[model samples]
Target: AKWREPKLDGRITEDLTINELEQYWNPLLFIDNILSETKETQWLMAQRNETGEVYLLERRRIKGVFLETLELNDFPLDVQDLTITVTSERPESEVDIIPDQNEMSAINVQTFVDQQEWKLHEHVEITKRIMKQEYSSSMKSHACLSVTCRAARRPGYFYWNVFLIMFMISSLSFATFAVSPDKAELRLRLSFTLILTSVTFKYVITQSLPKISYLTYMDKYVLMSLAILCIISVWHAIVTLLDPEHIATKYSKPANLFDLYGLQQHKSFLPPDTAVKSTNNTQNETDNFFKEHASLDNGFADNLLAFFLGSEQMEEADQSAESKTSTDNGNLSTSVGDQQNTTVPRLSNECSLDNKMACEEWKRVQIVEQHVFTSFVIIYVIAHAVFIFWLYFDASRRRREMRQKDKDYRDFLRRHQQWQQQSLRQRDMHAILRSSLHT
Candidate 1:
């Protein structure tokens, strides 16, 4: 808008100066400033032949005046007050700092006629800056710090990715609830899952941000989310490692409710654990199960319970007196033994019978563990799938609704436009008829 058309010098084709101005003051010099000079330059932008397209030489000189407050820097300077006069790349130095250059060079550049003022919307992207510390020829600057910086627009998907990442982290947290406490793999799986979730979060978020040495706001948020999940996983692992009743005490509502009701009648799971009671209980239970076949001593119940929990110790006891006697009696009375053996059961047959029962017990244990892990995993998977699907469905529904609303709005606008056009035609027709009748 501040483009001035210079009159051509009669003999020199005055447009040469304008062409020069255009080249020197190209669009890249898009700064807001007054034309600090009234004198016109005689520089030529470019030469052209007949019916020529002109190209101008582009060069720009800008003087940036800023109040460099004392608080901005911590280092020493040659002068406290300074008014730096810059023309093109050369910035003229002042022996003593000055303000508002009254005049500079052979031509004065402080004021110009009929110039338009431009407003700056944003600051310039300074690729690099040079800071000088000395003014005198004899005195060298203490240091020159050249800084490099770049400008970037914020990513359009910033908030969208944030929501997605948070949703995934929260989903992973929910995933932890799907593990069973009884499964030994639960703790490891939880830790591994949580760790992987954290890693995924890091990977996803790192792509969205600059590589600042210090963590950004979004980084802190995502890291905090991961930490919370890790804590949940760790807490779950610890709880699962503990006794079931203890865990039940900590987590189960029924256990808590029962404890509240039985608060007065509290029975200890490990009351004193006296040696006598432990030993006697173990012996009695063993006698019932083994029928006096095995030898057992004190603390057997506790030891047995501990073993069941995870002691990895098993006691192989001797066969019963009846079993030994039956074996001996069979061999002693060969004839009678032969007749008895034909009628009586053999040891091999008994072993075979017991093997079947042991195998059944093993299968039962396996089935129990399988069902527990399977149920837990399935519950979590289903919950996760449901939640993810819900997020998808909700987003889809909103988008569909928005589209519908937009369609409706456009239809309304079209109808209103048609009505307005019709109304205008009718008014014009009435005016034309009135004019004709008057004429």
Candidate 2:
């Protein structure tokens, strides 16, 4: 007769043994979606020790697939729950499914396996359930054991592949804003190309996921990026279509004055747009002023000759000849006041046109370009700062959660050790009491 040991701690019932009641013993255990199976007849040893106790041990390996429900809302940062179920094919009367409590968190991950992309989360949980047979005619319930495993996907790889790509495309779009508005055609082409590239990137990212009904966080992010890029593209078109004449009129500043005479302390502040016109106008005025009154005064004649003929000797000779002519004419300026009133004002008015406002139109264009570029830079910087802040805090929160989980696991292990130590002490005490009672 085969006898079972009582469930009392420290009770010494040494006559327990298993007699080979039958030649073969089989247990019907079923694993769903098994990939491979092997059947080998192995010798089972039931050793009898001096105390008449028997021990039996067995080992086997079976590979199977467990379908899991994946929640990919956060994607690369998402966590998944995997379940492994073991059940007997026969009804409860024939066999009962039992859970091995000691095997909790006993998932054997190979040391050489690539764990970079995925890692175990916390530990495994074991549970038992009665699987009701609703449609079958037998109406028998099978006992089932389930093991729940949690795993988290590593996000660094996807950060480089997906999020990094999106960031680069966004930065490229921002770069287009700095492009000179004068190159309207080129700017438009660049904007269009960037928009197309964003679309292509979105397509590539989506290809990695299934055609699910709901959008994941990655989907929302990609959409937001595309929308921002589209806005930038529209702004590009706006800049391209800006009216040149209107911009010139609106942004052009007062023209700078060119002083050929030391009277006004000639400041050469001419703008870029009016440089050519101012140069031509100044040359013409100098020529006309000298031609009309070349014989007015010896000093003035010398200065004029010097201005035109780049020679000190020629100017001196001209000054001497003019002085002799004035003496011969006997009209050596009746009054200084008359010379000033008749020559200075008329020459000033005739020779000088408004040299300050030469290239008002082109200057305005430049002003508009600077304003647009500045505004774009401000917007880009603000948006970039916000994006970086969000990502930084998000990563920090995830790290905190991971740390909390580790701490909790450590506490659980500490409590389990305490419980095990207490049970061991109780067992030792009970054995001592029973041994004394038997003596």
Candidate 3:
């Protein structure tokens, strides 16, 4: 039941009482501002007295959806202000939509039905506003009661429903970085799966919200998360290109001497063992010839001098003598074979050195890969920390606003209830007096 305090005129007596002969009274009501109306509402009571002072009561069940401009910049942590405006259908000259101060106070936290998605921030606020007439060019001002209900979204619910899934998808994508870049097909497949999972989650989140032109905080967060997944894919692609040779022997022994020696051109440093053996034999033959020819020199002193400081012809004569002696003695061949056997160990040592160098190079490559992974891990951690911290503070700010509004709403409810009880008692007393007079 609603009550309206009517204005009384000075010409009429304030103490005038209604006779028992008149049992009922009806007063005209002019309420044209309500935009969303329900059919369950009906006029039940209208009582009046001689001074034209009227007391009215009506039973109404109002239920309808109101259109509100939602600001989604903050998204999940955003606070929203919803309003229901009641304006007068008539011009200000004819009627004014006066707000009942006492009635407004009666509204409390309990007035708003408990909802899962949003929490009431404060008590409902009522304000009187003057709106211009819509059609007429001569702007006529009409009074309206703007009722504001401030509320905030419960972010925890959204975090679990949407963000939890997104986080999981991003994590799966990051794991792909650990996979060897050599497996390009496998890596690409996993990355695509993770990316698609993120995209699916994005679609789900968007479906829950109204279509809007601007990006919300949730939208930005989701897109950024997907970007992180894409970055992992990109990182792997780069790693693959950087170490293409590594893939061929990814599963082989960590120390690949053959690959290392091949890349460094170890063959260029030494000729074939067969060529080395033939050259060594030729040099030994020339040395023997020089000794034989020296014995036939002008004298021992002359031979020594010629051997130490001789003309180019002295070596040529030595080589010619050696070739002639080799044709005469078959035992010279046995000496050449002995020298070849002695050089075999040196060839084996060179190969061992090459193997050692190759192993060291392989170790260096592994260290480089470790460093790359470590750097990426650090970047990933820092990125997540910043992202999470920002969201935490934003959600906290929304919660603080909601708490303040809720406090105000509770206060309003208490004041309103007290006024309503007092009004009811006064009305009961007035009714008793009228019944006594009639008897």
What are the TM-scores, per candidate, against the unseen true structure? 0.31, 0.58, 0.60
**What lDDT score belongs to each candidate, Candidate 1 first?**
0.39, 0.57, 0.57
What local lDDT does model 1 show for residue 213? 62
- Candidate 3, after superposition: displacement of residue 311 in Å? 37
Candidate 1 stretches greater than 4 Å from native: 1-154, 200-210, 245-439
Q: How many clashing pairs per prediction, in order?
A: 6, 3, 5
- Candidate RMSDs in Å, in order, are 19.5, 11.9, 14.2
Superposed Cα deviation of residue 247, candidate 3 (Å): 9.7
Model 3: number of clashes?
Answer: 5
lDDT of 1: 0.39
* Candidate 2 C-alpha RMSD relative to the actual structure: 11.9
Candidate 2 colliding pairs, count? 3
State which candidate has the highest lDDT.
3
Q: Score candidate 1 by TM-score against the native.
A: 0.31
Sorted by TM-score (best first), the order is: 3, 2, 1
Q: For model 3, state the Cα shift of residue 157 in Å.
A: 3.6
Best by TM-score: 3
